[model samples]
Target chain A: MTHHTASAEELEALARHARWLVLSTVADAGAGHIGGPLSQMDLLLALYFNHLRIDPSDPHRDDRDRFVLSKGHTAIGLYTVLALRGYFDPAELATFDHGDSRLQGHPDMRMLPGIDASTGSLGQGLSVAVGMALGARLQQRDFHTWVLLGDGEIEEGMVWEAAYAASRYGLDNVTAIVDRNGLQQYGWPAGASDRFDRRDPWAGKDVGAIFRGFGWDVIDIDGHDHAEIDRALETACGARGSAGRPTVILAETVKGKGVSFTEGTYRWHNGIATADQLAAARAELGQPETVGVAR
Target chain B: MIAQRQVWGETLVELGASDDRIVVVDGDLANSTKADLFAAAHPERFVEVGIAEQNMVGIAFGLSTLGYRPWLSTFGVFLTHRALDPIRMLVSQTGAAVRIAGAYSGLLNGRSGKTHQDVADLAIMRTMPGMTVLAPADEHEMRAAVRWAADHDGPLYLRIARDAVAPVFDIDTTWEDWAPRMLRDGGDITVVSTGVQTSRCVDAVRLLADRGIDARHIHVPMLKPLDEDRLAGLLGERVVTVEEHTMIGGLGGLVAEIVAARRSTQTVTRLGLADGWSESGPDAFLLDKYGLSASRIADRIVGVHSRPVGTPGV
Candidate 1:
């Protein structure tokens, strides 16, 4: 009930702040999954800052929409968004991944509020969300289950397994948004180089069609475009009540978005920024030059 | 006694009838895993998660968070290995209330070849942090353990056997006691065994009685959350541990650790399959080859009873 609707301009600002915070926290902690989180920040902002029906005052309400960061290595970004959303003090983002910090490399539901399921290992988060959506059906609750997964994680067979089960159950209440930057832990997978001259690295294949084949309501859109992201969110939320098919928002994102050197690259996916790299990223995000150096 | 898997399926149906939160998930092995009994009773609550064990575990973990007690069943081999990480993270790490009935475990899947046989399940389940591992001796204990598991506060793995077993204890036996149940009392040697091996030890007692030697047979139900005092009490002059598992981290390894730490003077002899795969055959032949038959167990206990005190046998 206390949600503030973010306009396109405000949503862009939120995305900027999220990207700045993600780079800052990873830079401070000396390590994190920077590329994927940067890729998914705008998608997260559209949901958390505007669309997601959650209560910061009462985080565990049964009827609230559930958001699971299945691409859980992106805790730096989600932790920042959660803090900005008032789940906790914003300053705690500095202590992420440090010794004795509640913000571990992966998200742990037991360690923090506003977290529905703890995840880090790829491919299982969607299944958790499927279970939640099915639970909402069985328990007669009117809440939504939104999961954010990574593109590389789709390689895991378990993701397809979850895809089949979600489709079988007709989980209209579940919406899975994939941060499809197209590169995994290592760079583009081996066969991609020979496939399409390495251009449109999903090998010129469509991720939306993949989900469509699995019987999901597919929405292919630019993840960084606030308007497209909002439209997909509205379309997904409109099918909320029951008997609706599950939706997969194929958000075409750039890995390491917002920072010039790291954008669309794999080098900064799992690492700490160097002094120069950190300064470059800050300047790109137009963040103030502060003394929070990478330790 | 009935088959542990049968008892598991029946108890699931009975539990599902009474508890609205009880939901059963099967991994395309409903007939083998015996979750079909629950399906018949409460089809709405029974979910066939196809052949995907990994997704089945994740789905169960999801349901547990929503105030529902999710019961999962699949072959021990696939459930423990195929979805091990998901079970560890979704269920074990968070201590979720996901009661997993690991069916067709141990060398009991004699005709199904090496792939179906899972002697390492006890070790794998035991190694997980905060996972409650239970391998009951008989159907009575299996039913008791299943009932206890339905209400057990956290993640639990109940190992079920493929074959039937004779009743080792009363119907009202307390499966959650975490202590070994003493079957026969004797002072010469303490023979601790679990799962179907416990019954073979009972058969071994008759052979020992004929040789003027006495044997104390103890049937342990809960492999993890072991009762330290009961284990210490059962560790007599000579200790013999037998299990339908490998000597790695099953009953034998667990008992040996306790004996070594608490009673250093006690000699511990372990009887189980050697570090190798079991070939396809009748369960009896495999048991005999592995030195788990009644005669082998009888001879083992006699050897331990006659050996000098604190003299360990390989």
Candidate 2:
């Protein structure tokens, strides 16, 4: 249950490896989300590798810290992190999104270990984390609950409802991490005459202020920075930022980070990467190329 | 006569005394849903989640994963309509052991009108995978159903009527098994009902006997995972279903599905809120207007009984 603190440099290396795994997994599956996973990879790597108090061998231990991916569409990122964390063999990830595979299109807690809750529908996992925090209080357990949400997914009213509950209950044991990637799949499409009309409607909203209004302690950090992610997570878990109030870390990030072509664009939000594109992405990440292997 | 919500609140308090793992989550209607009694008895275990039913359900799902038995109390309409997505994704899909106490079910919410009245909760809950749907006939059955729900370790939905209903079962009667209770025995035709309507059906069967109809009455407390074999065995050639819900998909739909799948020669006459919404009124007035009162139900059964085979009856 002790934190295996990794240096920022080691965490950055881990994030790069996880990003490669995420993109390769999605491209091999021929269908999966790319942008959100790439954007959220650093946050997941920082939490799973350095922060979360979980044992991969005993994933279902009662006192283990729980993590829920509220914006579950980017499950490939979480799956890659779990694989690298030794919860399962990294080789098993090849079956992701395949029929009868434990790695589903969305995270299925019942089907896979280390997955705390089954979540695909957005905006519900934070409430589940709040309940887990409450349960820990009622049971007198010290385990913490961490939930990752998407900036666009916050459009759901249920997310705010959970935000209010987490604050009203004084759930200091739970922390919410928002991937402020500044893009979504669909938005105001550009008309023929106006190319500037196309943009993410959820981008530029004051998400941290809204969470603060909900009585949460807001921490703004660069999501792709491992040191900032680690620091914010530590402050939140220590209940040092604002005692008796849940903390929400609005991690500013770019959609499709770490890839030159996909970064900051919504086109790669969810699509298959062609063979050449996958090779280019691997080459960019400094990974050796393999011939005739989709994965 | 006692309201089912009252029994639910009292039973929750009783359960909380023995099991500390029991928690109650309410959506700001604690007093109306009678969850206030449990909150008073066990303040720490009671979670007041404001007017957010969907969040209440999600919280209960999370608690269920942590080995806590959390019961969410709210109006049936909100639980089944507004919070159905969470109930489906978090509770039903994962088979979480979260109990949903859907109060103000049916057409009797103290004149709260159609918005508060829940006439289709049974149909919605019954169709959810791994969901145990129950509608007690009266206070006695409500007490038993609450206890059963606590002991059960899966997703469950308890439909509770807002108004006081006539008792159909004895005080000592318990839901020891999932079988439809036969309240009356006769030979001519079978009358099956669920929830509060079962009590009215009991009275209607008595009135039918007075008219020489010889009706048999059956009360099904458990709607989902229904005791189909037992119910199918007890059904006669002519079966009439009565409920406070819509005729399309409640008890009537269940009976029709069972009979048709059995391929038996039985004819099902479904009597309910005839394909429309009901206006807000007193429970008795609404029942009478919707052809669900004891006398009206008896009259409808008579029409069905006297009609010749292969012809539609009123």
Instruction: Supply fnat for every model shown.
Output: 0.70, 0.84
lDDT (tens digit, per residue) of candidate 2 on A22-95: 88888788889999999999999888888899889999999899999999999999999898888898888789
Best by TM-score: 2
Candidate 1 regions with alpha-carbon error over 4 angstroms: A188-201, A289-295
Q: Write the per-residue lDDT of candidate 2 for residues B1-314, one digit (tens) a residue.
A: 88999999999999999998799999999999999999999999999999999999999999989998899988889999999999999999999999988899888899889989888998899989999999899999999999888789889999898888789878876766867888888899999999999988888998988998898889899988877989999898888999999888899999988988988888999998888888988777888888989999999899898887656423
DockQ of predictions, in order shown: 0.80, 0.87
Tens digits of per-residue lDDT for model 1, A146-256: 999887788788999999999999889999998877677764444634321123345657778889898999888999999999999988988876446899999888888
Error of 2 at A219 (Å): 0.8
Interface RMSD of 1: 0.7
Single out the weakest 10-residue window by summed lDDT for candidate 2 chain A: A190-199
